[model samples]
Target: MEEILQLLSEDARLTDAQIAERTGISEAEAKDAVAKLEKDKVIRRYKTVIDWERAGIEHVFGFIEVRCAPERGVGFDAVAERIMEFPEVHSLYLMSGAYDFLVVIQGGNMRDVAYFVAEKLAPLDHVVGTATHFVLRRYKVDGDVMVERAQAKRLPVTP
Candidate 1:
C-alpha cells in the first residue's frame, strides 16, 4: 500500500496497471488498494502543479503570518475554519514560533491581497495581527523547480 501511494505521489497520472507493473503486484490488487484509499478519504485529490507565470497569468501570492487569540471553547480550530471559508485563502497551516497560522492567498495584484487582509482577515474577532509577505517569484513548488538558471559563459584560458 505504501509503495502504491509513493508511486502515485510522484506521478498521479499513473494507471493502476502501470502501478501493478512497477510494484510487481496484480493489477486487481493495485486497483483495489487505490479505490480503498479514495473511499477511506486517505487520498484527498490529485493535483497538477502548474507554472502559472509561464501561462501568462498575472497573479499575486502572499504568505500571511497571523497571530490570533484562540477562542475559549473551540480554540484555534474555530478561527482557522473561518479563515479557510474565504475563497482567496489557498492554504492555511498551524505553525510553531511567533505566528499561530500561516496563510497562503492569491489575488490579481498586491493591492488586492492587501484589500483581502484589511477587509476580510483583519475583521475576524480572534485575529490579533497579520504580517503579509508577497511572493516575488516561485523558483520551486512541491519539489519541482519552476525556473532553471542559465549557466555562465566563460572565455577559454589562453595560458
Candidate 2:
C-alpha cells in the first residue's frame, strides 16, 4: 500500500498495470487496492499543480486570515462555502485560535483582492474581519523541493 501511494504520489498517470509490474503484484490486486484507497478516502483526489508565472495568470496568491462569528453550526462552514464558490478562492480551511478560517485567494492585482475584501467577504453577516497577506514566493511545496539533496549519508559496508 505504501509503495502504491508513493508511486501514485510521484506520478498519478501510472496505470494499474504499470504499478502492478513495478510492485510485483497482480494487476487485479493493484486495481483493487487503488479502488479501496479511493473508497476509503485515502486517495481523495488527483490534482495538477501549475506554475502561475508560466500559466500566464497575472495573479497573486495570498493567505487570508478570516475572523468570523462562530455562533454555532456551519457559521464558518457556510462562509467558507461562499468563499470557495468564488473563482478567486483556491482553498479554504476552518482554523482555530485568533482566526476562525484561512483562505487562499488569487487575483489579478491588489485591487482585485481589495475589491473581494470590501464587496464580498466583509459584507457577509458572519464575517467579523479579514487580513490578507500576499505570498512573495514559494520556496518548497508538498515536501518536494526545487533542489533535491543527494542521499549523501553513507550506508554500512557489508561483507
Off by more than 4 A, model 2: 39-41, 72-75, 146-159
Error of 2 at 23 (Å): 1.7
Question: Tens digit of lDDT per residue, candidate 2, span 1-159?
Answer: 999999999888899999999999999999999999999999999976666665677768888898888658755667777778888887888886889888888757878988887898878778889998988876675765544378878669956
Report the lDDT tens digits of candidate 1 across residue range 11-58.
999999999999999999999999999999889999988777998988
Which residue pairs does candidate 1 place in steric collision?
Answer: none
- lDDT of all predictions: 0.93, 0.84
Measured by TM-score, the strongest candidate is 1
| Stretches of model 1 off by over 4 angstroms after superposition | 149-159
TM-score of 1: 0.87
- The prediction achieving the highest lDDT against the true structure is 1
lDDT of 1: 0.93
